[model samples]
Target: MKKNIFLVLMGILSVVSHVCAQSLPQETSQSIGIIEFVLKNSKYEDTKCDIHSCQMKSKDGGVSLTLTHATMKQDKEEDLHYLLKINVQGTLFSTKVEVRYRNDPSKQTMKTGKRSDEVDSSYKTEHRVLRSWIQFIKDSTTSKS
Candidate 1:
């Protein structure tokens, strides 16, 4: 009778585990694809964007965005917090950019800060503010250029 009871308990445990696994949150492939597309198509004016790296497949549902001496990582689903570190020219400015995603209008912006030469030792530094936004532009109508 004890052996039968043990087998029954094991079966119940296995079933519960399977159910939990099925209900666990999973990152969709579409999100990764969108990020890759944007990164590949992004361009910086005269300055070249090098050493591009992305971590959209994070286990904790966090995504990392980096370019050269700049890095930004955020996990809105897990925690409503973001961290940004950027080094432009010869100046280093680190600040948090407010991120909002809702009602079909998503926006992100960073406050101004005085730049320093320690950020990058190759060029002059000055106070500068950087703002970036991403929007889905629908190809409504196309004409020959």
Candidate 2:
């Protein structure tokens, strides 16, 4: 009975906590600007992008947005409750994220695997903000002939 009760409480807590995280629109202009900046400044090898977009996959058949700073804010939302501040070492910058329990203030769960670089190896949860930027670049670019 004790074990069952403990598990039930933990489950309820998890749900409650998750319900509090926050998420913004996936295609916001602010997101696009950040993605463009990272892609242009990262020097990630053969990446071609302006302040507006990035190119398709490289000839090497791989894409990596290595961050060069430590925890840059990708969104302008003031109520950063569980904002996930991530810092990578390669694509663009290297930095840490300001996340609580691996969720944004509104607990936006990142389901995509496009830009999930963890600066620290001990982390298990991936940041979706980064991935969203990466996807934006890919989606905006025109295919080469």
Candidate 3:
């Protein structure tokens, strides 16, 4: 009798688990094609953009966008270059965005900093701002299309 009851309970548990799994909402996935199309049609104010391939398979063939901003120093007419790269990957049913920020100033201007080469430094607040900005760009571009 105990053996029969144990088998019955196991059967019920399996059925319930299957039902729950099927009822759970699945994440909406976007295709790489759509992502590429949206990126091509997107535009940013006061920024120059360069789009290229990142070649990450898991991210459904990654796409990279380098947004460069040049600001002129107040005292000197030197240009300070800031580059923020947004790496986008589309998986089977999800999209991922990674942001990389860097400061690329002229050798003369960069002398004031610790390193002469491009500096890769960003704060949490900056990341939040960039994430929102990227979201805006994505939304605006999709809406226009």
What are the lDDT figures for the candidates, one per model? 0.29, 0.38, 0.38
lDDT of 1 by residue, 38-135 (tens): 43354322222224421121222232333222224434342323323322221232232222222222222222243221111111111111122221
Per candidate, the number of residue pairs that clash is 2, 30, 1
Tens digit per residue, CA lDDT, model 2, 23-118: 234433244345446545543334455543334333333334322221225333332223323333345434332222232322333222243322
As a TM-score, model 1 comes out at 0.20
Q: Per-residue alpha-carbon lDDT of model 3 for 11-89, expressed as tens digits? A: 9999999866543112111222344454555443333223421111212234445434444452234343333344554
Best by lDDT: 2
Off by over 4 Å in 1: 1-29, 41-145
Order candidates by lDDT, high to low: 2, 3, 1
User: Model 2: residues >4 Å from true position, as ranges?
Assistant: 1-44, 56-59, 64-124, 128-145
- Greater lDDT among 1 and 2 belongs to 2
TM-score of 2: 0.21
Lowest summed lDDT across 10 adjacent residues in model 2 is found at 117-126
Q: Which lDDT value does model 3 have at 117?
A: 22
**What is the total number of backbone clashes in candidate 1?**
2
